[model samples]
Target: MPPIPIDNEGDPRLAAYTSIREKDLTSGHGARFIIEGKVTLETAVRRGRFALESIFIADSRIEPLAELLARVPADVPVYTAPQSVMDKVTGFPMHRGVLACGLKGEIPDPAAFLESGVSAASTLLLLSDLSNHDNIGACFRNAAAFGASAVLMDAQCCDPLYRKAIRVSSGSTLWLPYAQGGTGLDMVNAAKAAGYEVWAMTPRTDAASLTSLPVPARLAILLGAEGPGLPDEVIAACRAVRIPMSEGFDSVNVATAGAITLSHVFTAAV
Candidate 1:
């Protein structure tokens, strides 16, 4: 079949490509969606999704994406364009000639998602006021790497579906469980309800160091945002704990701290 050459930027078919960030947050009826650049698109398709809608490519750069393009369904439209038009359509530079849109049906409910759905819910990740998209994305990627069950955020935090977050995550946000409501206080309450000891990672002297927290049958670790750490109230909510970082350094990036904390916390608790 001949490729569909969408030459004009204003073509109705190019609508979704125009404002990528907005398009991403639209929760369509069918499935939870994700947008993938050419390289990441390959990984997403291999991992499996509910549906693969279409693959957009630049005519000039088609060779690199050709093999992957061939794998897309015959009826799914694969639209191509010159490099300049492709960039204009996508609202970003360096698209490398492709973007793939996919839908997945498996989304975890906010309250129960962290249950781990395996042998005891051992690992968890908490976010307090982590506003940076890049940082949150890194946090999700790190959470997944550490075998964490979910990434919990306060209601005021950034949207995980925000375009920059998705791009930075390499679409890994779709692979993990997450939610935001109330504050770190809410997460502290939920963790307790779920039968886990809640440990707030802060620098206060009264807190138990990570070394001493009990090896509960289950555990939840609360990590805060960049500068402010967790609110005093939220920290108060946790059983009270710290990571014992070396003196002099202020504090680590929230995601980095979480990665480190999770590694140790899970080892002790589960």
Candidate 2:
């Protein structure tokens, strides 16, 4: 389909793209979420997870993205506007000049997804109360890199579908299968019941060193927010493991820790 011209930012068809920053800060993108950047957009299209509501791109990007835009279903409208209009519509400077609105489907039940969505020799990443989009995205990227089966997050965790999170993950969030909601303990219990050994990552000196423990065939690495870390009760519910550091240092960034632990599991499982 040919690109449709969007001469004005206030056009009703551009409603989803308008005031993006304000909307993201308040009610979020609602039933649909925004996808930004060429790479992330490409990943979203290739994954075919979310339904494409529409795509909005700067007129300058049409030729460059011609091949990619062609792959989009004809039913999905592609809107092209000048850089200034795009910036006004999105409430930000149009840098990458590519954006898409992806419609979310019904969220999967966390327990059922854990029990049946994954099978033998699977590794899952469990996140609790992680607020930073960058950290969440990095963890997803690491999980995908190490071939983890899926990611599960508690109610307190930030949305992995957040635009920044998706961008930071280099679009890993677009492809990764994840379920959100439920408590940390709820996740741990479900994983345990599903035959996964839940390992809570912590900084406690007394916790078993990660290097000292053998990686399990079916493992779930549980992590928490940066400063407060995992709740005491949540940690107590699982086998606690700590990554070794120098004499004084006891911890690393949550995402770094995730990469380290996931690499161990991936290497051992393979």
Candidate 3:
């Protein structure tokens, strides 16, 4: 399809691309989310899990991104605008020159997603009150790398579809299946009911080390926010396991912790 030339910043056709940074915060629950940068946009186009509602690119990107543009559905609008217009529309530099609007389907219930015939050796990750977008994105990237079946997060977790998160995940956010909603305990119970042995990652001295714990036939690892870690009640409900650290160091970034734990679980399972 020939790209539509967007001359006017206020054109209604470009509404989805306007104030993108702000919209990334308020939008996405009702099926729409923004995709930024060439890598994530390419991932979105290749995955086909989310419908491409429209695409807006800086005129400078048209030639370089021609291959990716060709993969987009013919019916989806592809608009090209000057760098100035693109920056004005999105309220940013638009340096990457690629942006897209995507429509995602409803998130499935945690129980249904867990019980949906997941393999016995599968590993799942549960996040609670994880409000940092970068950590969410990095965790998703780790999940993709380790072959985690799905990532489930409580309502307090930030949206993984947020533009920065998507970009940081290198578009793995689009490839991985995720469910958001419900409390930490609710996630633990659901996983237990679905035949998963839940392991809570904590830094407590008494907890078993990740290397020492036995990998279960089916496992779900629960990771919490940075400082507080998992709620005491939530930790008590599952087996508490820790990654052994040097005596002076008690913690790592949640994303790094998740990656280390996921690698351990995946390698053990294999």
Candidate models: Cα lDDT each: 0.69, 0.87, 0.87
TM-scores for every predicted model:
0.81, 0.95, 0.95
Candidate 1, residue 180: lDDT: 62
Query: For candidate 3, lDDT tens digit of each residue in 124-143?
Result: 98999999989999999999
Per-residue lDDT for 1-270 in model 2, tens only?
Answer: 799998988899999888887776213344788898999999988785778899999999999998998899999999999999999999989798999998876656468777675535478999999999999999999999999878999878888878899999989888788887788889899889888899999999889999899887788999999999999999999999999889989889999999999998888877
Model 1, span 1-270: residue lDDT tens: 446888788888766677574455435445444465665566555654336667677787577767776677787787788888877776777455666655544444335554554324576777777789899888888877777776777766776766467667776676566766665676678777777787788877778877776656667778777777888888777777776777775477777777777777556544
Clashing pairs in 2: none
Indicate the worst ten consecutive residues by lDDT in candidate 3: 22-31
Instruction: Sort the candidates on lDDT, descending order.
Output: 2, 3, 1
Clashing residue pairs for model 1: none
1 against 3, candidate with superior TM-score: 3
Count: clashes, candidate 2 = 0
lDDT of 1 at 215: 54
Candidate 2 ranges beyond 4 A from true positions: 25-30, 116-121
Per-candidate alpha-carbon RMSD to the true structure:
3.5, 1.8, 1.6
In order, how many clashes per candidate? 0, 0, 0
